[model samples]
Target: MSRTHATPVNAVDARLPASGRLADRAAFEAFRAAATRRWDDLWSVERMVVSVGVDSSSLAKGAVEVLAACRRELTGSDAVVREVSGNGALWMEPWVEIKRPGQPPIVYANIDPSEVPALLTGSLEERALGVRDGDAFGGIPALDDHPFFRHQERIVLRNVGVIEPESIEDAIARGAYSAYFQVLFEMSAEEAIAEVTASGLRGRGGAGFPAGIKWESGRKAKARPKFVICNSHEGEPNVYKDRRIHEGDPHRILEGILIACVVCGAERGYNYIGGEYPLAIQRFRKAVADAERLGLIGQDVLGSGKSVAFRVRTGGGAYICGEGSALMFSIMGVRGQPRTKPPRSVEEGIWKRPTIANNTETLANIPDIITRGGAWFAGIGTEGSKGTKLMTVQGPVKTMGLVEVPMGISLRTLVEDVWGGMRDGSTFKGIQTGGISAGPLRDDHLDIPVDFDSMTELGGMLGSGGFVVFDQTVCVVDFARYMTAFNRYESCSKCVPCRLGNPALVEVIDRIRLGRGSLADLALLERTSKHIIELSLCGLGQVAPMPLLGMMKMYAEEFRAHIEEGVCPTGTCPISVAPSALVAAD
Candidate 1:
């Protein structure tokens, strides 16, 4: 399942922007003019910035509108397209030089329709724009159509949705290789670790382990030819953040992966993206080629004389592959089953050499941290979970998409305020957050902060930020059964707990849904869940029982009603007779 194909040059310039040497102002103008001259179907060439709301959930539609407008306007005309950040929009027409990250895209300062001579005379129009502050709205005169600006403190995900896929120049334009360059040229391996440690970026791949701790351990490990693995195989359903980043911003991700290789003294790295994400595979492969052509990846990058190589490896549609150890095994051509810890991935991983495995999101942040100081990055989010998180908020929500928000915000704020409240007027039943690994949350838990520690206490951990909400009509029993069946289907048969326990749990839920369960059955199910959670070797088994346990805890009456009254309270059980059906006919 290799999607490694050499990308044709100019395909990028045709599709997105002119990369490489054309990144400069003069080259940008020359390339833009040349491309525009070749294509005669040009329409208006005015610089337009389409703002997608600051929320991650706004990305899909926001991206669609921005692209649709860009296509509608620039389809025939080869215009200079650049992205600006002042307005949360993907600026298509080159209003400002968006060659750098952290800096806002140029805004038209002191614009006067009075100066229509440039437009009337057909002369090049020049406008100066300043970096507008957040509070600029209150003080500055707000234009009727000025784009809404929203920006979060970024370190890990600086280039995610901002950059074009596979464009090394785009990544560089977003401060891509600067982190590795800094590490290679300025900072020692220890200094790099200290910077990340100070930044307080916990692993975004469900495991909230501190990134610096992982690096320190890997650095201290006594293994030569160490390895680093970029875990992009996002097995969690509903979580599209990683896939989107991989498809939309592969270069920055690779930059982070390469940084890990340098910091941990690793010789090789693998980007383990799942088979489900075909677009991601294509984009990442193209990005790799683009990076190589620009001397970003492979053999002595950036005149450091340090050789590092990488390959994009696709998994066989296994959720277990997301587990760090299993990811390493999959890269080594073995079944994607996780091994035991103690001699963790740090001490012995891919090919049994001390290895460091990080999620795509985690790797994505490295460049920004390197470009901007760690302290600058650390200022966002809570003290514990410093920096932002990419959360995929789907199901029972008006705005169902990905969002990057500062940690420590209440779940209530995210669900109600940010997501535009649940789908409709239907009262929020609960949330199935963190995917199958996480438990459910009731209304009472809304105040729970969205950081790693707070979520765990409320029966849900931040597992890849796949938060699926269910409205009032959702059946907790059916929901639990659905999750149990999912675990049963995906469970690797490497262990008896997950292999047998998952199916057995599913059967228990099915029996209860069929009105064949007793109170004792619930007790037995609880015990079974305990066994699975405690004895399972990998993350799958440990978290398979989460839905069942959480549902039982949150809505025990729902299950009891199914067993006692032979009625699914939420009217979801297939076997349950409707009130209308039970009513006597004349």
Candidate 2:
């Protein structure tokens, strides 16, 4: 289905103004009103309507005007423009086409949501009258011109919301290889690290460690045959930011890794992906092939005197794989488990070589930093954090999708304003930030800015952009237990503390929920939790107790009621069905 060529504009991107593509609300409203008036002029012949994304057989609201403008500019007369409502949601509906005096109107095909209520449900007096089978809706008409889309966006997320994942050329046009080209042609080993350092970018896959620091460590290490690893192992339960980046912008990650290889003088780079992300793996593999075909991944890239090869390595669906050292072990065909520090992955990584392991998002940021000057890239986010952060807004929100926002924005704004607040118009209860490792925050804490240090102040670190919101109805005790169970399952059994600690902790919580718990059970949980946090081998085990600990501090009554009366105050636990545990009448 050929569309009448309209470009898209992301309403939130700050770069839009620089490119002169930002649309004023009033001008856009005028365009919409004019389009509606044109529809009123020809309400009889056309019968159907639709809209879609810019690339996937969809039209911008301005596409209709562009079409009209094109017709008038070329043919110089008014085309009969009839708007018609289609049968389904706007994404699936067909575009309602206008007909020239005697010509028949034709509706375009394959709209995602076919329902077009705006044009269909009105009397002429009420201003809702639409043409028969031609009424359409969901049109944002100000962004149809192609020049609005010409900026080169680098954050390993260049392809998202811009092109269909299946399209290959979209990646090519987005400046995906400029960094790789620089690494191969313009930069030497130390020079590449210097450029990255100049960018002031940190690892976006959480930890917020400086990317240049990691690269510098690996570059300066004495170990021969250094390694560069792309950590695609997204093990967080609700986190999907990495998976989307790997799937949609594979070349960006590839380019980043290639740059790392050049800077560290390593001959090989490995992409370690999580087992659960099947679609991500498939898309990345195809992207690898596509990059190789274009001389971006393999030997002698773009006629430059540098060559490095890369491959995909899969992790066995373990949350621990997101940890840097654990991923290195998994890449070496061992169980995905964390190792002790003193010799970090930078000094001694896979096969005991000088390895630089970075998360998928961090690597994705490299190309853009190098291609665009570091100062230019650094100016986007807040002062400390120098780039836009990608976050997955899910659970009890009006719009549940991937979004990238600047660092200083408050969490409340992200939840209440950006996501349109709670789901189903329900009251906002709490939010679980940073997956299982993150602490839960009630409504009062939502105002915390979502940067690394700010979130940590509220007992929640910016773990990995997984912002799972809950409404007032969700039970805190049940939520803790559910998360505790996940921690138990994902614990790498290398250490006795994490292995024995998580399961034992799960059982204690289970007993409390079952009405069989004693007051002593709470004491045991308190002591055992402290021991686990202090004695666990790696960050996973240390952080696993966070949810339970947070609940004990934030909602202690919920826990106490479960243990003291066997009745879940929130009515969440199945064992709360019994009545004897309830306090007898005094």
**Top candidate by TM-score:** 1
TM-scores for all candidates?
A: 0.79, 0.75
How many residue pairs clash in all the candidates, one count each?
A: 9, 28
Poorest lDDT segment (10 consecutive residues) of candidate 1 = 1-10
Candidate 1 local lDDT, 157-257, one digit each (tens): 45544554544555555555667767777789998888898889889988788999998998888878798898988887667778777765677788888
Worst 10 residues of 2 by lDDT: 8-17
Candidate 2 has an lDDT of: 0.64
Task: Mark the regions of model 2 whose C-alpha exceeds 4 Å error after superposition.
Answer: 1-156, 164-168, 564-566, 578-586
- The CA root-mean-square deviation of candidate 2, after full C-alpha superposition on the true structure, stands at 11.7
Q: Which residue pairs collide, candidate 1?
A: 41-76, 42-76, 42-77, 50-89, 51-89, 56-402, 56-403, 57-402, 156-365
